[model samples]
Target: MTDTVLVTYGTTNGSTAEIAESVAEVLRKAGLTVESLPARSAPGAARYDAVVVGGGLYAGRWHKDARRFVRRNRVLLADRPVWFFSSGPLDASAAERDIPPVRGVQRAMKRLGVRDHVTFGGCLVDGAKGWVAGMILRSGKGGDFRDFDAIEAWAQGVADALTPAREKRH
Candidate 1:
């Protein structure tokens, strides 16, 4: 009865994907079976016992694929333990204000009764591959504000929440 957790993300310049991988790694270390995948390529939600979906914030909106993935899997996600995260906001102090998960995300969360949602600071490398990312970096507003410790701690919390079910089955 071990829970299989799906860690999927949508990203414009790869930062969110990195965050998803980190979360998956932490969950794996905690003894959960985890799968890290892009939202666009994610398999059926029925294949997992729990789900953690994340995406990059762009102009106050989540990556479209992330939103679409949730929409397509609404039935399955609604019946499972689902969580969400957002990776964006260059200013670490402004993580809450800069990327509020948007109204659409909020609505989806409410519908699915999502467990929790977190917002983490994002990365802005000098030569990011996306056009919008490159423009933002060139504007002198790009800097790495990701807090790995916070991400790890959050993943640990997720593992904590999911572990009880496994223990019960044993």
Candidate 2:
């Protein structure tokens, strides 16, 4: 069996956290050992066979804390299979346009040699956010755009990449 670490950035309404959890569940059901944690608390990826790093995209940028985690851990992650994802875009049309995928995350993924990368539609509830957060939320056009089926399918790809070579021979 392969061991995996799925780390992500979570936020106030917890939408991104839920997305990360769903991906972790998919990886777990695939018979791999997996760990999921907030990016601020995430550890280096070198100890694992594979890593999946996710971020909540806001204002066309990933959370600062998550970006820093990927930055500090980049060298360690380059040696492992690293998959990158962003929770973004509230609508299918915007998703097609890649709204929240800022360039920093792209650069980080490129530096780490990410095997799979994508953007998952995320969520926003006016009632659930702080004052400043709500103000910023209104400017962008997105809310709960996450497609669970698509998220799972992407995760399955990660699972396939992390699958044991011995298993592949079977």
Candidate 3:
């Protein structure tokens, strides 16, 4: 059977889920079979040859379901390649503010032996989301901050990583 890769992620307002779908598309284009699924709806971890997990940041933390998925499959994950990413810290402007959530995510990735990790800016629309999300995104900056180019680049990178080096060469 052809090897399979899993693209799994959790989303608060669906941005991360879109990113995961992008990743899956890139992998599929490169000839690798990929299944994009929400963390909650995904097959148990370790079932695929390679795995990419992503999540949206909520209150400075990853979605609970994403965290649980990693913790539950820590061992199997350590045995194979796993990539992690967090969709967060959508810059409100050149605030020169706090560090990105990716810093903490990196630490977690290291412990899990994740092959790679990334943090991408996301978007929020005033009143478009639920009350909690709306309140947080409203009084603050509200706009679509997701960068499609950045998303595509990340997706391509994942596809490249999945390809054997020898095969990557023309």
Candidate 4:
């Protein structure tokens, strides 16, 4: 049987959603049935074989709705294979800093036993954000810093993990 994977994300200016789509594509290529959705619209986690949740970072926190989804679904998530990712760091140099996920949601993630957490480089488009975001961009760090190759590699790793389970079932 084909495994089903759910890729859910919360995006501010749509970058994280694009990232989530990229992840879904990679998983699809790995032969898993994939469904990508915004966190607010996610039906639920019960039907998926694995879950991937990602969100954009703002002011050192993930998008609120994304965190809330994990919190509300904590029990179910704990019983499944789940991975989390955060998209932020507007420049390549910043990507090397390795910031942790927002502290407020760490407990839920721990309880859920998330498989892995990754932080991807982000994109900043001119005038796409609020005044403060614009100011942060103006601080000489504004561009699409996302590394698609890295994202694909990580998705492949998840696929690798799931492959063993698939083989076992067969």
Give candidate 2's total backbone clashes.
2
Report model 4's TM-score to 2 decimal places.
0.91
Pick the winner on lDDT between candidates 1 and 4.
1
Candidate 3 lDDT over residue span 1-170, tens digit each: 35688899988678888888988888898888889988887877666888899988877788877887787777878887789878766673312333344455666688878877767776676545678677767677566766667777877887787788426453
Error of 1 at 18 (Å): 1.0
The C-alpha RMSD in Å for every predicted model, in order, reads 1.8, 2.8, 3.3, 1.8
lDDT of 2 by residue, 18-126 (tens): 8888888988887877888888887766667777777777677887767887888788888877888887666674446644357987788778787877788877766
lDDT preference between candidates 1 and 2, better one: 1
Once superposed on the true structure, which residue ranges of model 4 sit more than 4 Å away at CA?
A: 94-97
Cα lDDT for residue 59, model 1? 87
The residue-by-residue lDDT of candidate 4 on 27-108, one tens digit each, is 8887888999999889788888889999888888898768877877777888889999888888785356666777755766
Candidate 2, after superposition: displacement of residue 107 in Å? 1.0
Highest-lDDT candidate: 1
Q: Give a tens-digit lDDT track for model 1, residues 16-48.
A: 999999999999998899999999999979989
Better of 3 and 4 by TM-score: 4
How displaced is residue 27 in candidate 4, in Å? 0.5
Ranking by TM-score: 1, 4, 3, 2
- Tell how far residue 152 is off in model 3, in angstroms: 1.4
TM-score of each: 0.93, 0.84, 0.85, 0.91
